[model samples]
Target: MTIREAFTDLINQRGWYVKLEIPEGTANSTKKRFLEGKPVTEDKMKEILQRAGYRIKQVELWEK
Candidate 1:
């Protein structure tokens, strides 16, 4: 299925808002930053989306 379709499925399954924050930084920079929300680990979100059959792209997570 298309990525958008997968995303829609995830939202429907969750039945609630799902906010994910990913850290973005280079080796020189140690500061933590988020793409969609505040600083947060990306791995944790991966686990949750696995069941939803969708993967986060562009460092943003899907919310219901």
Candidate 2:
């Protein structure tokens, strides 16, 4: 699934919301953009997943 889809699912499953210290207008705008399927940065995605108690692992595969 796409990142946006996964993010949405996680948010729904965990009832997660952005609670930044920014102004209400900016926060609302960000939420709107996110719901509109705007692309999220990789770093931001990692941060969110980490905050949700998820761990990321990288594994290398070699082909013979």
Name the top lDDT candidate: 2
Per-residue error for 31 in candidate 2, Å, reads 4.5
Q: Which regions of candidate 1 are displaced past 4 Å?
A: 1-36, 55-64
TM-score to native of every candidate shown: 0.29, 0.48
**What lDDT does the true structure give each of the candidates?**
0.41, 0.57
How do the residues 1-64 of candidate 1 rate in per-residue lDDT, one tens digit apiece? 5444553454454332334332223311212223334543445345546644465556656999
Which candidate has the highest TM-score of all?
2
At residue 6, candidate 2 shows an lDDT of: 57
The true-versus-predicted C-alpha distance at residue 42 of model 1, in Å, is 0.9
lDDT of 2: 0.57
